[model samples]
Target: MQLVTSVNSHSIAVMLLTVLALFLFTREKIPLETSSLFIIVALTVGFTIFPYEYENKELHSIDFFSGFGHEALIAVCALMIAGQGLVRTGALEPVGRVLSKLWASSPKLSLLLTLIVGATLSAFVNNVPIVILLLPILTAVSIKTKTSASKVLMPMGFATLIGGMSTTIGTSTNLLVVSVAVDMGMRDFGMFDFIFPVLIAGSFAIVYLWLVVPYFIKERRAPLMDTSPRVFTAKLMITEESASKDQALNELILKTDGMMKVLRIHRNSNDMYVLPNSKTIIKAEDMLVVEDTPENLKSYEKILDAVLYSSLGAVDEEHPLLEEEQQIAEVIISQGSKLNNTTLSQSRFLQRHNLIALALHRSGKKTETVLKDIAEISLKIGDVLLIQGKNEHILELKQSRELLVLDATSDLTHTKQAPIAFFIMFGIVAVAALGILPIAISATLGVFLMFLTSCINWKDASNALNTQVILIVVASLALGGALLKTGAASYIAHLFVLSMDGMSTTFMLSGLMLLMAIMTNVVSNNAAAVIGTPIAIGIAQQLNLDPEPFVLAVLFGANMSYATPMAYKTNLLVMTAGGYTFGDFLKVGIPLTFIMWITFSWLLPLLYNI
Candidate 1:
């Protein structure tokens, strides 16, 4: 094979376009999908107008669009749906329960376990769902234990990132890197081919996240109030299977450590109500009137295996208060609102709005009486209501001027199908790990089973496919392919080699990884991986060495997306939930970035004996 020593016009054009794309990707003013589409169109038009000639064959314009239907894209989309199945079916809820119990026993040990669990789950599951499952659990834990959420969330999020690097299907970025390497005429890597080096490097990263990172993160208070979050009054109906079904009221209170305050118990079977006392025995079909924050209300529902019922009727198993499509949110009755000064029964709230009124809250108000019927209780201005409905209905309510809706909306879990989803995910991993099929085929099969088993519907599956990620992967593939085909990658590689002339392979590897680490934090990690991979291979070729070690360097470096919140979606999630500032990310991410970079810089050379 021959290399192009001098950069040509085509190479210059591709290089310039790559820079423009990176600029647009990082700009908050422009949407990412729009920028990705623009790159594809620009590449197609540029190549069509001026065809690049190589070995008596012209590079066609249609070739650039091949990434739309690429195998890597198929695998990525399939895996996303599979991950969604896990989330929608609440397959990870059991893990949340275990973590909750662990946190109650010991906070310090819990953080370590949380980091380890987050990392372990991310090694096979997508990082997004792993974080999603743990987010609410940790938030509830923070409130219950009176700790700053900031101390735990950032560390947990970064730990999942470290774990994502350990496997091929751990993240979409890894998939793109491996797929691109295979396309570049390298031997295809197995699922666990590069796991050893990543695991060795990730172990140190995880330890840092568990111990030092939390101390660097400052404590931030919850939103809208400094002393306490808004509290709501809700009724918890105990069913036959509830954990507190036959327990005494005093025992249940002791179990929660007095976190749940029961005002009254209404036994519908006898149409009798009683004030909660130590000797009061809770039976099936009994509704316990409780007061707590919206988060705690939901948390206690899980703890007691009870359902939050509306004032109209007791929610039984047959007609559940929550479904997979429904979501719970908080809305405040504002001035001049339609429901202002009107009782729920008078306003016909549930019928008119297609929403269920689950509970009511008044600032600094507590009732000592039975409060027999909440539906007849007069609503007042500045009162808060806990509501449940579909997403579209919730959005509709948000648009209304009558109520001030809060930013929090939580999805109700569907635990019935959790086992099905777990088995489907397990089958996908097992098949791929055993070399029975390519990951693309195995993951696609798992998605098909998910649909057949009704783990997820078509609408949810389609929603699971991220348009931004799809467009970015497609356009980055086009740009990376263009660079390689036009000798732009080789030209860049040669220049890099000249700059580090007389340096050892170890030093060149370190430099390349550091460059990629910086680039990944500022741009899309997928873009960094796609563009950096070929340059890494080219540099290895220039040095007359195997390309495996250099390619691994690119893979590891591109995953170092820890230094900025904009670098990854999970960071943004934790930022909003933890109320963290940009400086907080820099406070923790910069040192953690260098930690992994330095570790891999030394570790990779030794592992590969470069």
Candidate 2:
């Protein structure tokens, strides 16, 4: 319980304090990025306000902010931009489409297929990028197959974690560990050094998911077609005296309180699957299957003097009137967004964004009722909005950080650039794998090429950087460096060695892995790996043991983010989207964590001959 007083110690203490504060306050409440920014500011101020001497020199102020320029930060940003290019160019969509087709066979088969694909992709690519590419496709498939999103999202998250450990470049943590090891005079790891253990672990995880996941998971099937809460189908008939007589069906629906989806319109005994121009005059006895609720339908019924008709029919026509002024884009509302708890009319979403909320996809259910007022609607995390607006207007709305568009339909025309984008990404990976260039440099260059090729516009490139992730990574790196420079890592390692002096190597390695697994649940996987790697290496050196096994233990433990949602970003991304409570993560994640822990502990010694 010695007080830390040196400049480095104070900086480290302040950083730890900031992280602790964030852990206490934003554990399950605030966005991770906001918490990270808060900690960054705290560290900066802690270092500036309480100046302390380190090795007879005042701690350099620049060190506190230097992480923003770190190679890892640059690499991550570049990777995100490159990922955006791949997405915009539609390079990954074909793979996604094929995966979707395979998933159509059955839920069990779908889970296994997606697990394999996610793990394989993650092993080669960054997990975040892999998740970004797969999430939207999974959402679409869930809707199509009428499966609950909760069933697949966690599995995907775990798969990505396992897959990321398969290669040195798969995750920043692996690279960081490699760098630390080489700095400590150990042999540098090859790209495939960790692949065997990871593959073994991933195989066990996949089997565990297939056998045990279904039993613990509750089936959250969407209500049957009739009882579906959103997007109800109703028939409307136009009469001679109706206000909609001479107006286009689109205009009438637009002017109504409810946003209407016209499936089919019958006119003069001619069934037109395609609605005429929005200006097409409505004639008497015209029948239309429009999307509206009982109350809204009553109001429209009174206005059109239309009789109600009932039939289970599909609407195949796209109304020209609606097409001109209306557009559909999916928007995911972020936590603490200004639009939270606001209704559509009140927030003036229609007025400000020139968009209407046609439907809301929360968890797996779709609610189609138009917001009477948007500002009055409480916004929660992971609320997916199916917004209708003009094409230009929809793009404008997407620029706001409060929303993320799920489908980039507007960018589909750029699909022809897919091959070029793939080659750029492949080249970057090849250079890095071959050691011709550091991953950070190669990735940055790849991003530049993406921009030059117009795979992703510059504006989108900036957005794709994920500022929060960048800031968090930078802050954590700074903190890790401070820990090492201050001898905090050595101090802690010595303390651990003293406490476990008589323990055998097997127990020591297991303890280190378990400790890392626990630390990751509270701090972050990167932070855990960076802080733990040096101690693990130190422990191995102290015991005259190979550092590879010890470092591998840290890597394996870092990827076991199953015990808590805060351990990983993908967990939080699905929190609101899947309507999962914090407890839900623990309920499912804890068992999985234990499973991996036991499996790794038993398998590691055998694999590496520890």
Candidate 3:
């Protein structure tokens, strides 16, 4: 390949910084926020220290931070909040329930239907919540059928990625690519402009996921032994008239067959005791804060004849003064969640949400049995908290994006405002699709309606905005802008064209998609889309061909973030829920990636007659 000697030093430096940012993004040791901040700082300081003048216009340092308020970022955030409102109001839960019924009726038929439904819903709403909605249903199906969850989860996640490639508003990466392309003088793509190709390619992809991918993945058991493996810490109140009022703690242990661990004993408001010996005598009105899984906790309550409660107020629903419907559910802490790295006590979890956390489950890490210790430990992504509360309070928790409610048994029927939420979402898509309003404006207006209609509140809206996504999009924009300004994208494109000088247009398109597919798995898909969109355009310009096919290639390839858990947030979510390894993603994602890549590479050229 011949080198482009005419490329300026600033372009070379920007390219190097981009490479460094990619490195930082892929390193699990470095936090995403830190890497994004580093990249933004480097871009601003580098441009400020040595400003670059192109065509007598100097690129200002302030331009680097402009990405924070970029139109694409606004649209992405607004759409996210809107999607949250749909979930908050239970607008989409009915779909999940219907799908659940289908699964129960015919597991084999439902598997195909699952991929189709998942992909269809994902094309319209945010795919992450779509995965969140289906996750528990699939888990329940897996357990009921005595099948492994590992078989279905990865395929379902990949199916969403397929759907996300269909429309401009389908995925954040798609939005960024289209937004960048518009800024670079290409006609803006409509919401359904690219759907035909994606649907065509995605059909084959979905078939592979439904039929072949399950066999590729090994069957791994979900962490459910005699009930959910998630442990909760509940305080067992020894009532004055209970059967075991004066029983020895050792005797209770003997009765339970040594199955439970008594983490601590609370004698009174003024005194708390550590783990008691086998001979420790249990007294009336003493609070025994025990640590065990939910099933085992209830069993212990039955064995000791004590009432289990999270707060100090009431024992159960039968308490005459406190008559309300109660419920138990499992909620997982999401990545970029406000609850991440904070304790339940520190976050005032109970005081804020009015729900009591009975237990916490961290993947592969046994939580310390002491209630105080468990409360003090910082929560991480994928930590499942077994929580208990009134049905109302538990339903309210679903409004917030921080905690992913995994138990589908909760009554998530549409609220009075659910119809309004669905209408607003439909209106946003309609106006954008009809070209009556740009997506940014349509989505923004939809959010305002969500708040006005009481479908979503201030806290739910705020939590819906993901910090990592905001920062990464901003950083990707900054780098993309710099590349365009310095002609680095053009330089890279010229080199690529020269390297494949003798290759057919079909080979060139395949190569571009393949390159993007690899880069997306190793780095942020948003980054790949933002950066590759411009290069794809440049590659088209170099080849003296229309850029439409090339641009679509970039968009399709960037959304193929299926090869690793770290490639996308949805993948990370399923990793814990399904108990999958890194190899599992590679095993299924690699083939699926090639399937879509080859499909699109051949199909795009034919559609455009390139």
Indicate which candidate wins on TM-score.
Answer: 3
Tens digits of per-residue lDDT, candidate 2, 212-317, equal 8757876443222111233345678776767677677667777764355565677755765546456566777687767554566666666666766545332223
- Name the runs in model 1 displaced over 4 angstroms: 224-413
Judge candidate 2 against the unseen true structure and give its global Cα lDDT, from 0 to 1.
Answer: 0.67
lDDT by candidate, in order shown: 0.80, 0.67, 0.82
TM-score of each candidate? 0.73, 0.73, 0.83
Residue 338 Cα positional deviation in candidate 1, in Å, after optimal superposition: 26
Q: Top model by lDDT, which number?
A: 3
What CA root-mean-square deviation does each model show from the true structure? Answer: 14.6, 8.0, 6.5
lDDT by residue (tens digit), candidate 3, 72-141: 9999999999988887787888888888898888987898998999899889888987888788788767
Which residue runs does candidate 3 get wrong by more than 4 Å?
1-5, 228-329, 348-373, 385-402, 408-411
For residues 265-316, what per-residue lDDT tens digits would candidate 1 score against the true structure?
9899989888988889899989899865556767778888898874545444
On lDDT, who's better, 1 or 2?
Answer: 1
Worst window of 10 by summed lDDT in candidate 3 = 222-231
